[model samples]
Target: MTLKFLVLSSLALLTNAHMAAFHKAMYCFNGTASGQVNYNNDDPVSPLWMLKKSDYWFHHVNQCDDFPPAPGDFLELPAGSSFTVEVAANRGVTSLSFNGQFATDWGDGGNHPNDYSVANLAGAPLSSSGCIGNPNMHTQNQSMAAGTAFAISYQSDISQVTMDNLAVFTVRYNTPWKRVTSYDVPKDMPACPADGCTCAWVWIPNGCGEPNIYMQGFKCMVTGATSTTPIATPKPPVWCEEDQSTCTQGAKQILIWNQAEGNNIAVSGFDLSGNPKSPAYNSKCGFQDGEGFHALVAIGNVVSDTSPQEHRMTSLVHRPLPPQRLQQLLHHPHLLPPRPHQLLDRLHQLWRHRLLHHPHHLLHHLLHHLLHHT
Candidate 1:
């Protein structure tokens, strides 16, 4: 049997409405490795999709009609409507997105968790100065192959909509966000890391490869996307989940595929619209002239609540390393102790026991150098 859907714009336009949903199909995706699972939950106005680990690397979620940042994803409601948003996390939160941009809020001092942003968009003290945040993207036609649409995954907290004969679009959300009076970036302005966006540490640790991150990052770069394009910031703001910080120009994004490395971290699409992102992170927000469309194994990091909280300028630089290689660093003989002449004793033992290991193991040398030099 075929499924059908019905929509009522006012249903979503209202901050709190008593109206009922028209009728939307329910989609579900469940699968194992070497396959995909992108299921849509029941919701006409804003549907939900469940993506398994395998789906993370591919654009499986886009098949759902509710996916945002895509044209026609939003149905403008008649003026003077109200609605409410709700998000609940069961498993580890993965990502959030709003209107195809990384979810963000001008409500928080214009920054992210670092600042306290008021949730009250209705009471920002209306002034002729106009809205504070007006986000825009500088991506050109040459960067992402041409017309690739990037995901605005970020942390999102559900929001309630309230409008007065005017259509208002919310670009971001926060869960533990405290209410505040004014934010610097303004509600419409998109916020992002000024320069350099790589997720080498976050992605690699989680077993992500360079192929996907480079492809997706550049997809947004070339598109000139905003943090949360007033339509696609994923709600309930959770780590790895779509938020409004990255995806915007000069922004950074690091996707962790459910913590099981190798499950994700690869790009499934080769078309990449037109101008693919150039390999490695570019200093400029977007592609440079002549760079054309490109992709890479680049890595980057952005400031979150943890790790390098004080150093906004600090970023993670990472390269793929095998677990065994890392283990070697953890277990070096020279690191046992420094008895000055202990090396002689170790050598004697090595030869006497017929367990003659080399005195010049790379790991031993590295540890020996660190132990003595430090």
Candidate 2:
């Protein structure tokens, strides 16, 4: 019994040593891990190490696009809803089920036996004291973890998609941390083309590991969309971690860091807080949820289906009242808009102004409101 135990322990150590530390999107359409046997085979879905501005930068040499899903096998993104994706060190740990077919299960490859445990699921393994020990996962301090984002291109054909049109509609902070993660879709996102939209999940870890990034493609379609206002052109994100006023205002593109070519933003030094600056997917990187809606409204790109109340609010922001008229309304509350909903609309107008001009103040007010209301 003693000899057998020693042999098993030796084998486990050897296996772990041979395994590479990397992760990929498992459930993404045409994911490379469809039928992979080695749960730790990070080759097919390997991270882009010091990538250049070539085809490889786009969905890893376009291999992910090679295995297109069958008709109707798309990653569904319901408008005003959220979708979950399974991310793992390898596909073997996942169900390997896609397009109404089940692939071979080569076991969990002993890489993540504790992943499903209650403690692990609840993030017990992640420590706020520092980065998680596993280089494959994200840091425990969510604010410190490099963020991840989901960008969508209106083009249904993956080949037709380009960086300029791939607008990032949503961002997830402290991501690549768990096997199962969820991302919120914008309520006002426009519907995709008939063949469905081409989406990509991109990520870049803050630190405590390699400087590589991840980009996986997916065939997705949005349902229940009531808006036809197309997404605005995406510009490269800038490092506005210090002064949010400098942050990009409209739709933003994904970050391409540490690459030889096509690197949009660079943070080679520390930030105002004296921490290493890393462009992420959160507010620091100019990616605020629902910013698309606000941008469109601010630019007078209001959709036709917007509610009457919303239209009134948009008009109020664009068409400011004279000082005397404003003072008259302010002094005589009775002269203001009637109905409780109109009052709420006025408050929303104020909120929108605060959000665009004084976001920090708006955040403080939001926290205060949540504390008192909830």
Give lDDT tens digits, candidate 2, residues 54-109.
64445555465565556777777778788876554444344443221211211212
**Against the hidden true structure, what lDDT does model 1 obtain?**
0.22
RMSD of each: 21.4, 8.9
List where candidate 1 sits over 4 angstroms from the true fold.
Answer: 1-364, 371-374
**How well does candidate 2 match the true structure in TM-score terms?**
0.65
Candidate 1, residues 21-139: lDDT per residue as tens digits? 11111111121122443222222112112334333332223432223222222211111222122121100011121221211232111222332112333332211222111110111
Task: Quote the lDDT for 168 in model 2.
Answer: 82
lDDT of 1 at 230: 28
Q: How accurate is candidate 2 locally (lDDT)?
A: 0.58
Off by over 4 Å in 2: 1-44, 97-135, 138-143, 289-292, 295-298, 304-374
| C-alpha RMSD in Å of predicted model 1 compared with the true structure | 21.4
Residue-level lDDT for 161 in candidate 2:
79
By TM-score, the best candidate is: 2
